[model samples]
Target: AKIKRVKGPYGKVHRGFLKGLTLVWSEIREVIREWQIHGQSVWVTGHSLGGALATLAVAAFGEEAKPIHGLYTFGQPRVGGKTFARNFDLEYQARTFRFVNNNDVVTRVPPRNLGYRHVGTVLMFDHAGILQTDLHFWNHFLDRVVGRIEDLGKPGTDGIKDHNMA
Candidate 1:
């Protein structure tokens, strides 16, 4: 069967791919639950569309039984209206770092100030940002400094790919 060209919002000159937001959030929640790691802080990080979607998921968890712990992503684009950032910032009470490379245009779309109240957002502008040497160290360190959250694995090697998150 030939693939039909669906037009409109999901098409050209229109926001054709803005639908299915709820589904994405639902799946993210389910996966976190499946992890079965409760009472231990959580961090939602992603790249590109994953970042926007993950942000939505964290926002959805706001005021729930379990609140979002942190957020760190790269190459992520804007997801919703200006109010989105403001509202999300208000709802989320955690460390949020949004990395953006100068060459990556994905983080520069949809314009800024969407009626949302964001405390602040850190934008990383190079591949060095993704450098993880301590794996999940900074997250744990932050958790300790902030709310005494349970710590994860030991610090990874210096300059290690996963440790750069620190």
Candidate 2:
């Protein structure tokens, strides 16, 4: 996965995601416009890699002065850098919800060390499958420990299992 600098409301974005959006942006924009014309709200959603593309699509719509009703993503990876994240949050944070299941590893990348960051409100499901919002650091750490312990007899890591949409 490569990172590319883009000249727009989105300062930097995942290259692959940008390419994917470029391919279908016209149709997506048209659909949104049609929905708006019919007095319908446009909400976007996706899981994993599709989530990244959905984020970029919303950003594109915002740049074009199109309003989006809301966005929801499951087990989504980071799609851009700090600037892009800040911009996205500024424009859409109130209407965006990111759902992370337990230790789903997909939500943790591209790493913060690499300047990638997540945007919007996070609604996480803990190791016990309990929904958590605004979790404290200590609580998050404890849940991770519990998840690892529970994975002791499992064939694969909890990260993969938690990423399952089901």
Tens digits of per-residue lDDT, candidate 2, 106-142, equal: 9998888888889999998998888899678898888
Q: How many backbone clashes does candidate 2 have?
A: 0
Candidate 1 lDDT: 0.49
TM-score of each: 0.55, 0.94
lDDT agreement with native, every candidate: 0.49, 0.88
Looking at model 1, report the run of 10 residues with the lowest lDDT sum.
5-14
